[model samples]
Target: MLNRVKRFADKTPFSLTTPNPQEYTLFNQAILYGVLIEPYFTKIHIKHLHAIIIDGYKLFLSLLVGIVNELYGKLVNSGKEQLIWVTKEMIDVSATRIDSLLVCLMRQIVGGDFSNGNLWLCFELVSLCLSKWDCLLQEKPVVLTSALYTFLRLLADHCRVSNNLKPMMLRQMEIEFFVKMLRDQFQLCLKIGRDLFHVPF
Candidate 1:
């Protein structure tokens, strides 16, 4: 079935199905989270929440990988390749957004935002940071800086929620040991002269 669909799409000219890229991306992301991820986001189970966070972080990292591919100029150029790239990118971002949506879900489940829920908050924070992976890769200082600011606030909120969350999360958050990763991105922004304000990408 997938092969049949791919073959049909392959035969159609890009012009026939073309849409505004940004709008396409937005719609795709929304559908992924709203339809697919929402099913597994039940907060009654911390395991589900944990899974959401892990999936979100993975999605964010996927963006970083995509940016890397884009940087190396590996952007898909046609048919099957382009279709694969688009699908992968949308899935990555959708996974991340669903992770973020869980934030509001957690709030609903917990009866309020738990400031000390560092694990959830920080996971979201890192997602935001990596969300700017394009800006970072394209050397867009201003956008990266803005991402950093948002990341800081998310981290701070997590800190306010619960101390135990961090400690418990820490043992598992080993991959995120570089807690201040955003600071590195910030320095890069300053070094580049934050002059344009517009993301270069």
Candidate 2:
């Protein structure tokens, strides 16, 4: 994956500071990010994960958040990441993967082919967690507990109670628990409560 990115880079003659033309916006960034990090979720290494997250993770996450915010601003006034709330057209039937569909849906939300978020990062974390949900819940359960609780909160916020939110909420629970595990791993150890993490603030 990195090799493919390098090939693209070689052709463009641009620095990492320059977002790859393939990553002009949130939607494009999703494809590149998905191609690069999605594969590593199966068996992630701390060192490599560190490189991926810290290298430009902030920029990536911020971009995804920006996309969500853009959609919220343009379509819905709720100021939350609600697919149906932003664009009812998100409910489409397709054989494509959910994450890929998320990319496309986001593009549509931004209106006229636009997406500017780090959705792939979120997808990577959620997918990884779901893959190990049971084990993580039993083993590294403390953080998983926190993550799941938060996931539930997000589910409640997104679900209107009018729609059948249970299934989606359950899936999100798995993904959220996964995110919590990853978060407790080391992603936010540096940026979070530095004192709690035993780092000088």
Candidate 3:
């Protein structure tokens, strides 16, 4: 299974900064972020679970987050890194795809079905994205604003529920930070205009 996973990872054609157009797709990204991570859940040792798997899983999660961070940066950043020109369609699909994947991963990680380690990974992933909000604002406002809407929606949904799931669900301070960032981004959009995010902020 590990060999198969490694092969899959090696053959994964979904690169954000690649020059090849054929490799770009949400389906490929889903395979990377979703399917690639699934095997670990079942393959973990039953007895020496934490000793064998926890750290590796955490690292894998971190890698996923970092890939996404870079993906966003590559999309919105100037064309210095690309050998070929990026298209509008590429930008549109790449940004929206990441947003959707992150939301889906968030749901999977936070649900009771996953282990506590995976659950906490949700916070790490969210923080990774939110930490880049300023950069996203400058480089890819549309993507950033779309992300803000998704996050606000998630926050609203979380609030409506009674289950806090201590240590897994976000703390009040974290919630405040995210809210503040969203509000500030919304205000920035107002000054910048609807053209920034493609929607009225």
**Best-matching candidate per TM-score:** 3
List, in order, the clash count of every candidate structure: 7, 6, 0
Cα-based TM-score, every candidate: 0.31, 0.26, 0.36
In lDDT terms, how accurate is model 1?
Answer: 0.36
Each model's Cα RMSD: 15.4, 14.7, 14.4
Query: Tens digits of per-residue lDDT for model 1 on 1-201?
Result: 334433323332223333464433332233222222233321222232222342343443344344333432332223222222333343334444332232222222122244444344344434443554554345333444443434333334344444465533532332242234434444654543444242211
Q: Give the C-alpha miss distance for residue 125 in model 1, angstroms.
A: 4.4
Residue runs of model 2 more than 4 Å from their true location after superposition: 1-55, 72-128, 132-146, 153-201
lDDT of 2 by residue, 1-201 (tens): 555644432332223354443443332243333323433331222222222332334343344445544543453322233332211111121111223333333333221111233232233334544655555444444433344433343333334333544434444544455345446554433323423232111
Model 1 misplacement above 4 A: 1-112, 115-122, 128-135, 139-141, 160-162, 166-183, 186-201
lDDT of 3 by residue, 29-79 (tens): 333333324434222211122222322233333434555445433432222
Q: Which of the two candidates, 2 or 3, achieves a greater TM-score against the reference?
A: 3
Q: Evaluate model 1: give its TM-score.
A: 0.31
Candidate 3 lDDT (Cα, 0 to 1): 0.40
lDDT values for all models? 0.36, 0.36, 0.40
- For candidate 2, the 10 contiguous residues with the lowest summed lDDT are 86-95
Q: List the residue pairs that clash in candidate 2.
A: 26-115, 26-116, 63-117, 64-117, 64-118, 129-178
